[model samples]
Target: MPLKGSDSDDGGNDDLARLLSGKHAGKHRRRSRDADDDVNGFPRLRSPRPRDEEEPATPTSRRFQHRRRRGFVLCLRTPTAVVLSSAALWILFYALSLEGGDLVSIVARLGILGAYLFLSIALFVLAVLVAVFAKGIPRKTRGGLLAGLAGTCVALLIYDHDESLYHHGGYNALIFALVVMPSLAVGAAEIAIWKWLGARRAAMCHLFALFVAIFVVSARLSRAAAIWGRGFGGETMQPLARTCKPTKIGLPWVDLLPAGAQNFWAGGLTCAPAAKPFSAEIDADGALRVKCPSNDATYIPLPVTREWPQDWKLVEENYEGKLPQPFNKRVMDAIRRTEPFRIRGDNAPGMLVPRTAEAAIVTCDGVEKLVLRARRSNDTSSRTLRPPEQMTGSRQTKTLDVIVVFLDATSRRHFHRRLGRTVKKLEQANADGRTRLFQFFRYSISGFSTGPNSRAMFTGTSPNNLDTVSPVWEDFARARFVTAITADTCQDWGASYNPRPAFHFDHEMYAPFCHADFFAEDSNPLGNFRGPYAINARCLKGSRVSDLALQYAGSVSSAYPDRNTFVLAWLLEGHEGTGEVLADLDDGLVSLLGSLDWSKTALVIAADHGLHMGLNFAFTRNGAVEHRNPMLAFALPPWLADSEGRGETLKANAHKMVSGLDVYATLRGLGKVVDPTGFDDPDVRKRAQGGKNLMEEIVPPDRLCSDAGVPQWYCECY
Candidate 1:
């Protein structure tokens, strides 16, 4: 305590009262007057002046002064706590998201952190500045400071919309909703909280920590449930080719052409040419081995297409044309001359006498040829194989006419090029053959591919070598003389371009003709022919389309069409995502199949590839890759099964691995399609070996030929 009136000299009369109490107030006042007279430094022993000379200060004024000082102190401590707490919370939430936390936890953490940080920081900085510098200042000073700080925060949110802050760990929506919006609300609350607390730093700190703790608990539980409760394998993706060794070996019993068979120079089935031939071999490790000769065909014709046979489209085209010295186009020329029909239908005459109805033959010549029978057609009976000459049911016994339907359902542009080359080779066989010739032959190719005039393979010279190459639609269309109808197909339907658009999956218009007769069956003969047949390599070959047609045309009024003479069509719908197109094609097939006469018609369903839809890779390797399975199916006429001259049966443990190319061989056995060798091998129907045969295990037992009710040739439950 320095002399009370000594300091009071600077503060005015009010400070004199504050420094002195009771009797000291009067003494202090008297000394202040005397001290003023001395003035230079501390008062010397000044004589006491009369107290009447001093004036008194009011208590209200003194109280106001003290409050102003206290307010300043509170502002300093409170604002700092608010701001620091806010910053810490923001950092915590950011870290959690970056650490790959569960989505629910990430969101909850963000919300809690945002609330704490915004409230604390906003209040702290504003209150401290106001208390420190704005004492007795205009209201505009505090308002301007707070408004500026808030504006800065708003700008941050807008600027960060596209930043990683918004998208980290799949938190795009959460950031915008929780972090950004709640920030504004918390900011306002913080300003109010600071002002009410009079810049109490301790209170703001407590509030922020309390908020954070509550959210932390909530976030932890949410994260736990999101991560551990549900499985991540719901969506299975295809494994990358890099992970697995590509297996090139097909079934041994099936006798499939090797991957790069063109380089092979074989004298017979087993004899190799004396010269070393070029070939491609794929080892078990998914590695490719290619041996090239010094002089080889250089110009490999690459097929370009606009639309893929299915929903796929072509986006790129690349080809290098290199021509080698004339190796005989003669072998190719010879095969071109020998044309054999490759269609899906029946091709032989029946030997069994009908017990229920007259026998008939719906020939490919558009003539309904009738076979006078000794018995009714409806009788549960057998039919023997009639000689080729006896198929006409006439004295002259000419070759019988039969229609063949070919489906080329490929969803990718690459497959189109391959299938095109196969068709062209078939035309070559036609040009080379002299014995089997037909006048009214038509091969109509329809599906989604790149174009109407494209070939199916990358090159006709050595196709097996080009299996690694991607396919295009035009390659297949131009290969054979057959005409094709391609839809607006492409390689990819912009799935990579804009994945989240409202209507991203709109490429559903490329399905084949939707007809009921082709797939379904009604009682009408002429009006029921409708078909849904589009080609997509991605779908489950012929069976998928058949199933689709069944769904579209099936109803309570009629059962599936029982046809014997009609050749129905098929489309791979699932591969293309063409929902409407699939529905239409199925309806078309049903109507078409229904209109056909069952007694004189035969329908066959087939597939090019089996999809790997059932694998549970997520259980083992997480969601990684997709694979393809082998094709499988077989059909025989009901009449042939009852009256077979020799009752030959397919193997019991059939691997059920039927190759798509085997359809051609099967046609040759039926005699409707002509093979120059005219050789029929019963063993062709043997199951493919190696993998578990999906068809053998899945097909109903009653449908097998070995069943007592099933005919030898006809494998059906009925």
Candidate 2:
């Protein structure tokens, strides 16, 4: 059908092609303006040509013809305009690249970018002026106008992406968005002038513009891709020093490497004495408890009634995979009997949560695996729940949201291997100078296995029989924290490792269900992977238990946005195998790490130990090194890092020999916990007994494995 204003050319079924050539517009420009026909301030459009044959010369026919003319509308998009816009953009990008891509430089180049940004205001006023004063356009013509602009945008973006691959290092985001985009608008306006002359000439002009675009984009894209890809490559997190003790005899580069490999020095540090910022120790017989809040008030109400959260299925649904949007009845019906538990947790899992879920054991489909719904309903964190009234605010010098994740049997190298997605994203954020996570290059494990090592971090000592102590959580509780919660699939921790009364957390979640299911603590290592706790082949139901815990934590954050939360999660996915299976968690891990509210949050991600059970990984030389040295990383508040060179401080500390006990000290500092009795580690004028607070102090440069609390058998200080 012909467009209302261009009856001659719009009759063709090549509207998109016509739009590219700037036809189907202004065909009736020869006609005089008629104010009565105008809609709002826009001039009403009419066909430049009359009908081939007149309808009956009656008033009724004439009225019908006018209505038909008013209905047709079209976008006046043009390809020639796109070509001109491309030219102007190249100059802008070149200027931006020269100016260091900084804020001040950008403002200077944009002319109207200073404080008042008068240019932007003027543009806004100009648009308003056109909408208010311009005549001869119907209200629907505005949609057509937007379409014309949108068409130009689509063409530009397509050309740029295929040619530049901006993020793939073709052009930095700054130059691409700013210098190149607006040029298209300028080009589009230029072509509108040509269409005023006639459609035939404009269509002919599009051919020349097309040939030029093809030639220019082809000439530049290849060289730009090669240069930028090298300059702005993807980031890579190193698993270990490039040349470990036994592998130091070769060249650094492997020639062909993994995608996004840029950091040549991330693995530069050797097992040599390396560098130590500072270190000290205090004489102490046992680990010191976390300091309570300044007020030292307890917030636990008398009736501490407990129940599963209402939004458990929200997380359960995510675990089952991203549901299609719009959740139509058809979509809902398709997923009715499957995962996601749309109606209720128990309904979806087909199992009822036990009243005293702490001790109840259950199975999934007769196997020792749990349904995702079961995890949310039974195993998720509880003490972390804070009442709305308590969620008011904190009165501390600083209130940092703390997240502690204990990854079982994952080494620093293994972490880089399995959770590469999370690692790369955090690194990219770090590169952009945003809030991000960082890993310590020399975080040595203080204990042999998951339980003892983490216990040393949590309680400040890894004792065999002395399983009880003033747990670190008490300090958070006494501080009147809004919420403090821990979640684990098994009831007791350290059972597979230490073999004691199930090491109790403040609350046990999802343990009974795991027990009733096909829960086998490494004894039934069915597949190749093996350490212990490989329940139902490393899954609760069909989802990885790690993902369940991760999603649960995300849901908790979503469920309680206003409250301060302390989340402690134990991930057992890597414990039972070569841990290669952990690769599956890359996407989930990426989401969890990036989802945090980092402004006030403090994140700690550490592994208790590396590969231990698998003979292949455990017995190898590098494997042994990885086993002894676990990963410890922290994501502190962005402001703290920005002030006092603290980011640099963390980097320096990362290279120092540290262990879980030191982590205990750091936790005490972060919580701003004060021992109620005003006790300090004993200062004997000798070595410091307690672990060093990483923020306030550091482990001694020449610190030995024994000094840091690593037992002789597990020590690999070399």
**What RMSD, rounded to one decimal, does every model reach?**
26.2, 25.2
Alpha-carbon TM-score of each model against the true structure: 0.25, 0.45
> RMSD in angstroms, candidate 1?
26.2
lDDT of 2 by residue, 608-642 (tens): 88766433242345555667767677877777566
lDDT of 2 at 662: 84
What range of 10 consecutive residues in model 2 has the weakest lDDT sum? Answer: 279-288
Candidate number achieving the greatest lDDT relative to the actual structure? 2
Tell me the TM-score of model 1: 0.25
Candidate 2 has an lDDT of 0.46
Residue 21 displacement (Å), model 2: 99
